[model samples]
Target chain A: MKRILLPLLIVVVPVAATVLWAWWPRTTPPERVSDLYRRYEHNPHLTVAYIEDFPVNDTLTVDVTTIRALDAAGWDTLAKDFRIEPLPDILQKKLNEGKDLVTTFLAPKVNPALSMDTTDLLKNNVVGISQLIHTVSVFSIETESQINAVVNYNLKL
Target chain B: MERKKLKGKELEALLSVAAAEPDGLPGDVAAQATATGMAGFDAWGRRRQRNDLRRRCLAAAVVSLLLCSFASVTAPEAARTSMVVNNGTPRAQVIEGVRQILEHKL
Candidate 1:
């Protein structure tokens, strides 16, 4: 009995684990955004990294997207485009709570000519709120060169 | 079939012949060996049992360790705060971003 049981468990454990892994859902978010990004969400040059909460299982979402532009003028338009984003009702309520939630950081580019010192100027936080900080980032690469910046948005259901 | 007291080599040869033949030994000789008992076989059996148990222990330990690692990696993390790292933004999402920007204009 012992001989039969041990070997059976060995074979069954890994197979069961594998089946569980196969059944686990690892869904990728759809990349079907349209129009807001200079209509360049389709452009190979426009790279975006997004992470949001699953509506079915989660409530809080912190979405950070970074985009690049040709110069300060381009930055203005792009930043303006982002600023006009609508606030979800929950986010609006947070803003109404009299809490200053803005925090942004700046990072340097790889090009020596484009490199700039890192400045995380906006680093204020509410100790009781969250550990993850910062919601915006600006990258200043040589005066007229492309600027890569990030803006984070929070959403809740 | 006269009764003959066979010794040593003769006994060995007879047993070898019986082993080589499909008939096994005659029923009377088989019964005699069984009646005498199997003390030597029992000693070897215990040693084999010990080795089997040791092998099982090692295998079980390795399997449990692997299960621990797999569980940790596959387990779902807490959803208290989510900062999903999404790559390759979809067109519809960007359009949503633009919509938000437009709303900000209001």
Candidate 2:
């Protein structure tokens, strides 16, 4: 009995663990998203920004004109906040040509630094402004009309 | 001594003897040859059948392997799930949550 049970446990345990890993339900913590919003609320730079035809089917399209209006100073500030380099000359030229800038953020792989829940919510396959912003505030809500967003940066110079 | 080639009479006599013999192989030799031919054909047929079976099984295994690979690649990741807000949860709550997360990250 001992011989039989030992091998059985060894085989069954791994198989069960694999199944659990594959099929487990993953979710985002609501509190994390809420806390982010609360912090934004307390920020002094927050402003109400508008985008025409908002929430156009999972795409976050920022008007190039709006970004250009930021001039050099505002643009530099934005670049610093996002932890990315300043926009290239080619991108600025394109923006001047009346184009929209779209950016998408992907979820991180499972790791200790980034939890599965946070990554999953941030990088859900469904494209939305919320996902791009890494927030849960605008989840599943779409508007046929233009909408306003409370943003921390000036959309116009 | 120098050997003499067959004379015209000698050659004629040999030809007459050969012409008098049967035109086809002897009966027993013909039967044995036919039996050998049939056996060869049978062996060839069996070999061809085995080769065909082996090719079909190899093709099936390759197809099964391809299908398994496709299924594994296309399957959804284990940790990803759809975001569904509870009925009791207000839309404002979700929006606030998203805003906070973005503020921290950005």
Candidate 3:
């Protein structure tokens, strides 16, 4: 009984399962797609703003002209707030070209302290500004000067 | 099969004969008949046992098939996806053409 029964079960079980899986009606649900959105980030020198598309989060529908105008307005506010306009000509050129964008690091320039620690500042924003403390500290920006501004404008295009 | 039993005068005659010869062929004939009958019965018993074993094996195989199906079945998972869209802006030429069309109407 044991000899015949063991071999019969081994062969039959897999064959029966494969047949059942093939005949089983598919009850798979429809696929749901998430919304797409836009975001931009500033470079180390604060000259060029790199923009790219990513999945999830808030969706933004913006034209190139609209982006250019918004960037110029942001540059003007940046000049007034930080009291230092090192890359004005370069940023203005990029903004005028209809292709590029501009952003600031040491940005959202909250307090006017001459020297401040960059341990946990500028972490929560549209851009990943947490990495800019080292990059923006170069050139003549030894200490982030006192600049009072809520420059984080959520310009909905 | 039927056998005539010795009774009355027949039984007396057979008893007398058996008395004449104490060791006779009659006893040996009876013992041989019993042995043949037992051999036939034994053969039949062995055949029935084989049939019973075959039935048990078939029943076990059927039960194993049912259990295999139970083990194979499982709950299905849901399908989902994430998508990225470029939605590129209008080309410079296309925008210029649209602008030209609007300007002519103005």
Candidate 4:
């Protein structure tokens, strides 16, 4: 019995340690995001990486049905029927309630040929009223002052 | 009769082919001829089993190679994340769902 128990302990100890190592709560804390961003600044393919502490089961939903293609025909249709009022207002309301919702839209580059206006509409629509922060094309657009730089810099794509 | 175990894709392929050629004869044949084809059917079935095994082994080797290469490239940064919290459904299911989504997108 003593010999059997000694061998069992030897096998079990390493197995338990490995299990703990694999499942350990190994996550980067929120504060280190800035550090991470600086580290990957030169990385073009690195794209975007930011953590959101959203409610456990809820999805960060983005309804792209209203997003019109940046063609002349599409623009005409959007100018006639483009509505950004409801989404921003709804997002503002959600933000005021202390819900965690941060969405960043990124493309290969910030140009007039990229979809930036839609994100602007989202930012102008909700930031003051809600805690939601909308960063578009690497430029932060939560403030009224920062809004113009993003709007001007963003190509109409 | 030794029953052979088949992986998911192989089983589907076999089921589809079997459904297509339920009767081994090219056209409608006499019952006697159909009965005589049982030996041929067994031979064809064995050939298919061997082919399926070969295909599965090749697929497995390719997948293993791809995974090993990917891991070698990414393994350094795998430990960089300290806390891996998933914001989805059941924990295990969410991991699988996220993996599928990443696989498709990547």
Enumerate the chain B TM-scores of all models. 0.39, 0.40, 0.36, 0.39
Whole-model alpha-carbon lDDT for candidate 2: 0.35
After TM-score superposition, the amount by which residue B32's alpha carbon in candidate 3 deviates from its true location, in angstroms, is 11
Which segments of model 2 are wrong by more than 4 Å? A1-33, A48-78, A107-157, B1-106
Candidate 1 lDDT, A104-148, residue by residue in tens: 323333221222344532321110111011122222222221221
Q: In order, what DockQ does each candidate have?
A: 0.09, 0.06, 0.02, 0.04
What tens digits encode model 3's per-residue C-alpha lDDT throughout A53-136? 211113421111111112444444334433434546765565466432333333222332222335645321221111111111
Error of 3 at B49 (Å): 2.0
Q: What is the number of residue pairs that collide in model 4?
A: 6
Q: What C-alpha RMSD does candidate 4 show over the true interface residues after superposing them?
A: 13.7
User: Could you give the candidate ranking by lDDT, starting with the highest?
Assistant: 1, 4, 2, 3
Across A62-126, the per-residue lDDT of candidate 2 in tens digits comes to: 21001110234433433443333445888668656755344323312222123224523433211
Candidate 1 has a TM-score of: 0.31
TM-score of 4: 0.23
Measured against the true structure, the TM-scores of the candidates, in listed sequence, are 0.31, 0.24, 0.21, 0.23
Where in model 1 is the C-alpha error above 4 Å? A1-27, A31-40, A54-77, A83-157, B1-22, B25-33, B36-71, B74-106
TM-score of chain A of each: 0.27, 0.32, 0.23, 0.26
- State which candidate, 2 or 3, has the greater DockQ: 2
Clashes of each: 18, 10, 1, 6
Candidate RMSDs in Å, in order, are: 16.9, 22.5, 24.3, 21.7
